[model samples]
Target: MTEKTAETKVTEAQRAALGLAQLSEDERRRGLLSIADAIDEHHEEILEANERDVTAGEELLAAGEYSQALVDRLKLSASKLDSISEMVRSVAHQDDPLEKTLAARRLDEGLDLYKVAVPIGVVGTVFESRPDALVQIAALCLKSGNAVILKGGSEASHSNRVLYELIREATAELPDGWAQLVEAREDVDALLEMDDSIDLLMPRGSSEFVRYIQNNTSIPVLGHTEGICHVYVDEAADLEMASDVAYDAKVQYPAVCNAVETLLVHEDVAEEFLPEIAARYEQAGVELRGDDATREIVEEAEAATEDDWSTEYGDLVLSIKVVDSLEAALDHITTYGSKHTESIVTDDDERASRFMRSLDSASVFHNASTRFSDGYRFGLGAEVGISTGKIHARGPVGLEGLTTYKYHLEGDGHVVASYAGDDVKPYLHEELEAEWTPGDRSDE
Candidate 1:
């Protein structure tokens, strides 16, 4: 098909999504709850379709065409489906992000100004093998009153197709094409070019893939290209607690982006903490590559090079470094970190405060595991994706991130001449406690 043909589909979808944008908050909330219930009721169908995708993924794994991580993400169990349902329900119950008055000011008597949140029109999301992302993105879009066009990896095609169908059916009573699925790879290329209809593009995958989307598309992109996350153990950290937190951060879910890939330890604590953590990592089958000082403390660790510092292993392999001071650790992270998530384990409150304030990552933590950097964990129901970019949205993008605001001015036949002429009515720009309620029109 021609480019115009593809743009027409997106245009239709955007039109449908705009209809949803005009809906009352209660109407949208009930519609999302209904979609969540429908998903739960159709869990078996989703699981059956997921099994087909898993089988295909296994074949690809055996042929060396797919990584173990992709296969794991492609497979879906009953519990995962239930969790997806729960997240959908949670999003449905979240405060509607649309039409809430952010600020109000009285321009003059019988004239008022208000800023209200609204949807970002149509969002085009291209994600990799986690089929559950299809449901998560659709639910968040519906709750935020944005239309979305989803393109999931071919690895989970069967699962994504089933999930998309279920979501479309569940929200059928609303707009006709609020949630559209584009399965073909060529369609993604077409989508990247449709900047007019698609307001935002969120691509979730490798750094290269995200960069490719950002470079190829004129549509504003909102997502992290990589997640070279790190965890630092300060000199004042309790060695036992440091080891526990570090172990959990790497092993809780190594396949995810938030999993810590680099571990930095203060030189004062390195000798004692290194061996303890190394032994624990051994038990978890984690491979360690470290700097000269770290290797001196832990003989089992392999020699780490400059490249190791910036690598996102996304596996059990971890790179460890020994920093002489907190300043050195911060400098190391600033040079190599992906600005996704970083954490410092320390008992020194002042040192922790400095570390937290100085770092520029999306999420900074003190005395916590980096694994805690998640949307569900942050009580955002679930995320469309994590963004390391500093504009529009940052960190876990949930309902609030999916929306933008519009300024609404109400006036009684007010004209600029009244405020500008010699017979000028002195203008009042007073802040008002009054907000924009539904059906409050100045014309009435």
Candidate 2:
């Protein structure tokens, strides 16, 4: 038998997606649970494969070809495996994303229309590093009843191959081609051309890479680009609380997209808050670069260049700026932030509310850490990626994000001619408090 090409694989996934979409919610849930169990049972094998990738990644890191952040994301441990498995189960337990009635209205006496949720058919996702993303994306796609075609970064080829094979074998009872893994770099360009076979293309990577995907693909692209997130300490903020929030936002996990990259301090609190946070960051080995005002307050800080504001370091480096007021802070973020996630710490409810409402980012937090802007933390299970676009899905693209709705209309042998003719009847368009049952009459 001949080996299947990338086009053949995606085409098979497209056909399988139709069957997967018709499955019962419980059936899809079980398939996800199966994947979770398989992960737990074969975690040792996963770690072994991951080790090979990490070893090679470390050699590349020495050569300066790969960043420490990429290697960190590529390597997986037993604890991380546990978290990955648990995330899968969490997705399995989420509310059914399919067949939910979004809106119900009576068009006429017997004609009723319903907006029902359904799968988006075949999804082709290209993500960078983070082998765990494979599990999250696959589980979310299956639970939402959509087939997926995945392409991971070359850095995690070994890890991705193992995880993909494991998930494919675990879900053997389901449609044969529900999940397809394309390992070659060339597969991505091929995927970009299959607009007719794939319904949605989600790419998670650097801004330039995402732009490249968007430009080349005729298929609709859901892009997750660089995250230049921020944290602001308001003049009205409690200095102690602000210190803790700022510290956690940047230091907790600096390699992920939600991690804070810039720190904005109100002038009123800069003298006091900067020293405290700088000390903590220093203790944690964070390299701080600041503007002239920030450098004045923290003399030990290095001068921040203009480009630092828009860069996502994805490391233990932070950029600091001193803003004279909340308005100044907002202006700075609007100008340089990636519209990903931003947090403000303040005691004034009105100010907090204003800040939250004013920012157009995917998530704006008040009195909390910017790192809290995650799908798993938000209780939507794990995210395929954090989307910065204002499109069909924004923020964390989870199970619900993987779905789109279809309009279901039910009528009783009703003819359009009856509503048209000498006396044309008007549409009621009245809202209803009812759920849709398949084949059920609207008037009954």
- Total clashing residue pairs per candidate? 0, 0
Candidate 1 has its poorest 10 consecutive residues by lDDT at: 435-444
Give the Cα lDDT of each candidate.
0.89, 0.92
Candidate 1 clashing pairs, residues 3+ apart or interchain: none
Q: What global local distance difference test value does model 1 have?
A: 0.89
Residue runs of model 1 more than 4 Å from their true location after superposition: 1-5, 438-444
Candidate 1 C-alpha lDDT tens digits along 1-444: 553455666987889987999888787888778877887898889889999999989998899998877787787888888898899889888877888889988888878889999999999999998998999999999989998898899889999989888888877789888888887889989999888789999999988899899889888999756789999999999888999899999998888899999999999999889988999999999999999999998999999999999988888999999999999999999999989999999999999999999999999999899998888899998999999999899999999999999998887798988888678788789887766974354422
Q: How far is each candidate from the true structure, as Cα RMSD in Å?
A: 2.3, 1.1
Whole-model lDDT for model 2 versus the true structure?
A: 0.92
RMSD after Cα superposition, model 1: 2.3
Residue range 117-156, candidate 2, lDDT tens digits: 9999999999999999999999999999999999998889
Candidate 2 RMSD to the correct structure: 1.1
